[model samples]
Target: MARSGNEQVSYRRAPNFLTANEPEKRLDIRLSYKSFRALEEQALTLYGISPVEYSATDSRVTIYTAPTALHGYSAVNLQQAISFAVYNILVQHQKQELFERIVAVGESTYSSVNDQGRRSTKTPDAGLSYYYDGGTVLTIIMEVGASEGYTHLNADILLWMNEFHCRTAILFYNKECPKFKFPGNADTYSINDRPALEHTWFGTLDTAVLEVFKRDQNTDTCKMVVQGGSLDIGLTIGDVLPPNEDAIQDIRGERVHLRINFVRNMLASGSHDTAVSRFNHFIGED
Candidate 1:
């Protein structure tokens, strides 16, 4: 349970609302690959991590060696670094359009508004989102790992995406595997432009690839599954593990935590005010 002033709210039943006062302040963090790397470096340094131990060659950075499982800063904080880094990269690269279009709000704030009217504020351990240039469209989601500190809110994430009409959602877990029910469509489109069905996954670092595959088994409903490791190894040329039974423990250990950083993507294109207005218009907010 989370407290707001004198009100006590159940963490599971809170409402999600947009609390940005100017709407302009909402798009502060624009994300880009460059910025993401910088943030990763910053996080490593802050956490006493060494670049020598871990290499962030590109957008999809990973740990080279394994560490003691489950030893690192708060999962929430690590993910926040990812969210901020992604934003900084986008803004610094003058990828302002992406930055302005996408925004990062903490999971706690998101939960408060999601339930609305009926309750007080509730904070999720960690949460994030990427909105379309018009703000009306929520394009991406990042749900950081919380298997140990809190209950995994996989179902709630799905509910929020469906409710908000978000196109893509990503769930990052620390010490556990998350299952999704992805429903596919026969109609194909641009990689990023496809319908909401394709962009959902329970991302993890313990896996071989930077990302895991959660392909939808059905089209009419939200039915999907995870292939093997938390990532699809075929996409990247990096070395991938062949599926060890202790994979989760190996990655969740202390060393790997120090060896890795995360990335989030944000997008937008226009002036700050224009971006704000466009976002407001897209979200249908007065």
Candidate 2:
């Protein structure tokens, strides 16, 4: 799976069903643990990184980097870490059903038409897609990293909302100063009789905490607790749940509850030893 920047790597051999040349055609392919591991290794080699744990789908692959990696804190790693932490918390709280319904997929491609009726596809950093009635609905699409500017992020989010009809889109960054709104709901509104869409801003990692915790202090505990807020953005999973649960509703028509905490150190950058040591402590490693 070696690839140069200009090279197009083919996945023709990637389980026949997963290979689709048509934009509208969809395929479902399952991989065994060994097959998935092989794919991950191939992706890592393609990225020229050391062998590390990773995840992949039919279209995209993600290599999980440690907080102490020489590259420093990565938004990709942060996105996966936070998603998994939320997933685990849901499971621990006996909300397995909600957990099953809410799937956090990384780098998955989504296809839709833009406002101009042009077909387009985008691979969001992470997506919390919900399953209902034998189909999938993207509840939230998340963007990470500082490489992308706010304008670009917003344009992409607008596409996801206008084209894919996603309920919410969030951008997560570290390093950049916070300059976005807190958790708020936006609906399609008319301005000068022209339709305008609104998207929620979860802000930078620090701002996200401030919105949820209302404090600026750091603690050695290294875990940040997130709770739901009353905003039109979506439904509240529960009082102690993540604030972005406005669109999530259980099969029983009840508002699902969620609660999660993530290692703060993993989202911050510093010396490799300090980052790794903090990560180890958070995970209870000796």
For candidate 1, what is the lDDT? 0.31
Q: Please, what are the lDDT tens digits per residue for candidate 1 over residues 68-152?
A: 1221233344345544544544455454354443344544344334355544333333344444434433333444332322233
> What lDDT does the true structure give each of the candidates?
0.31, 0.39
1-286 in candidate 2: lDDT tens per residue?
Answer: 0111111232334423222222111111123224445654665555454564321221232222222231133434544554555465566556656566667667677776657886666667665666656776666666543422344445555656566666555554343233222112112222232211132221233433211111111211112333453112122233223334443333222322223223344444432333334233222211
Count of residue pairs whose backbone atoms collide, per candidate:
35, 7
All candidates: CA RMSD (Å): 23.7, 19.3
User: TM-score, each model?
Assistant: 0.30, 0.41
After aligning candidate 2 to the native by TM-score, how far in Å is the CA of 16 from where it should be? 41
Relative to the true structure, candidate 1 reaches a TM of 0.30
Candidate 1: Cα lDDT at 26: 16
Best by lDDT: 2
